[model samples]
Target: MSGHSKWHNIQAKKGKIDAKRGKIFTKLGKEIAVAVKTGGANPDGNSKLRDCIAKAKAANMPMDTITKAIKKGSGDMEGVTYEEIMYEGYGPAGVAMLVNVLTDNRNRSASDVRCLFDRNGGNLGANGCVSWMFQRKGQIVIQRQDGMDEDELMMKVLELGAEDFAAEEEVFVITTSQEDFSSVREALEKENFEFESAELTMIPDNTVSLSMEDAERVQKLVDKIEDNDDVQNVWHNAEFPEDFEE
Candidate 1:
């Protein structure tokens, strides 16, 4: 699996969670709303919307709530306008981090993010600071133990334009360049290959190994940044110890 999947699995095993449920919903809701706004509400016609809906379903969000979010985005209902933002920085041990956000109040979000970094042993940097260390890609995590042969699966995805494939923690992860993401996903779907998760995310080029103390500090910054009302995603280069939870 890709590094993203490893972190996700780690989070799952930890069984603990995000800042506040309400705030978490806000971040997710904005994603759905934005997707609908950008590409009409029809999932069949909007791949991004489809992905957002899938995540909403995975989170156990109600259908009515999802519909309401779409309506808000389509201007059928009034709501705060959300602006997408990205902040890059270095955490403890010089771990590179990127935080994606959607917020109506840019000033408030910026200050809160800056303070979070400062308080957590990190320092926010200029726009291009840590961004060059990452690449945007589409990733899919498949449960490898469900009768799927690794070599066969690798060949199949490779034919669909996947750049690389690997196995980790009993899961097979497929990666594709951003341009080929939709095509690759569709190919897999046509083959009836089931994926545990599919997402377009930032993947670090290389990881930074850290002492436990520094790792915890970086994680603390990550949690704080992600907790902000505007933040949508947090990515970092810190490699968690195999046994680290959450």
Candidate 2:
């Protein structure tokens, strides 16, 4: 499997825990709120909000909670207003890291993120330090089902403008240019396809392989950063050894 596919598979396994599920909902709520604030409340008119809603539903977030987040962002209800921020850093083995956060207090988030890196044998860097090593792409993941035809799926995705496709052990990963993400996703949805996850992501151009010990340290650092309520996504270029335990 590709490094990205392996990382995502590990994450999927970890997300089965109840505590992680709650954290996932909280993060999705923040995303919905921010999407509503940036692009109006109506999904038909706001592509970002529509995508957030779809993600929220996929995560099984309660309808009422989703509605409340929308209301909060649309000014119908009072709530914390979050600002998006990006933090760049390097983890163990010189692995480049990018953290995306939605924070009401930038200073607190920055301090927390930096401390995680420092304590985990990494260092936070100035803006643009590691970003140049990655490219923005739209990624969609669908769980592979019994008797699923890979050829058919590839053809379907290519016709819908997807840039690439990979059939991993448990899921099919599809990549698309950012501009074609929405249309491709809509087309797939119309065909009644269920997705494991779908979102715009930063993909590393190259990866840094790490020893088992260093890989563990980097994974811990990533977990700590992701557990922070303000953090939305954590991207990295660390490639664990093929035989490394999850």
Candidate 3:
């Protein structure tokens, strides 16, 4: 696994959960609404909605909140229309960064995002600038359990159409082509596999090795961006030292 992945796993394990839960729910709600608006309110008939519901459930979002979001998105209730946007940039040490956001006000989101980058020793760039340094793919993570057989799990994921699989110290990561993501996830779900995370993400082609200082700076930038209401996800290419303190 890359340093970015390791850092992500560590964050998942140790980040402040209670303080961030509300923000997480807000983001998931937006995703659910967008998914319903684009596809439909039915998860069975709408893969995007299905994925959103899965994500919401993983976050432990209440069923009523999920239902309300779907209703609002399907025009059964009042809600603001949101537009999806992607911002590309370079963080400290020339680390390529990608920000994904869904917002009702594009100008506000753009300004907020640009300000975050600027204040954090980075700058937002043109759309294709840093995007070219990354590839779109589906990533799924499952925690490593005591009773699990690594080889058997790898075979299962491969059989279900995953492109690659890696067994990290604390988790199993599976990669799939963007088009294959939903099917692969569905297959895994049918077999009763639980996930730490399952999402379509931007994977960097290569990473920039950063010193401790640079890594801290880049991570702070990432945290600020992620804390924004409209920002749903942030992808970066910085590779910190394995033993670097969080």
TM-score of each: 0.87, 0.91, 0.91
Please identify which of the two predictions, 1 or 2, would achieve the higher lDDT against the true structure.
2
Query: What's the residue-level lDDT of 195 in candidate 1?
Result: 64
| Weakest ten-residue segment in model 3 by summed lDDT | 1-10
Candidate 1 C-alpha lDDT tens digits along 47-136? 888878756654546789888888887886356677889999999999999989888899998999999989888899999999998999
Alpha-carbon runs more than 4 Å astray in model 2: 1-4, 7-19, 76-79
| Runs with alpha carbons beyond 4 Å of true place in candidate 1 | 1-23, 58-64, 77-79, 190-192
Q: List the residue pairs that clash in candidate 3.
A: none
Cα RMSD, model 2: 2.2
Residue lDDT tens for model 3, 1-246: 232255353344235334588788888888998898888889989998988887676566789999998987788535677889999999988999999999889999999999999999999999899998888888777878789998898888888898888778778888898899999998988888887778787887788889989988988898899889999988888878776665
Which model scores highest in lDDT? 2
Candidate 2 residue-wise lDDT, 53-100, digit = tens? 877766667899999889877885356677899999999889999999
Model 3 off-target regions past 4 Å? 1-4, 7-19, 76-79
lDDT of each: 0.77, 0.83, 0.82
What's the lDDT for residue 34 in model 1? 87
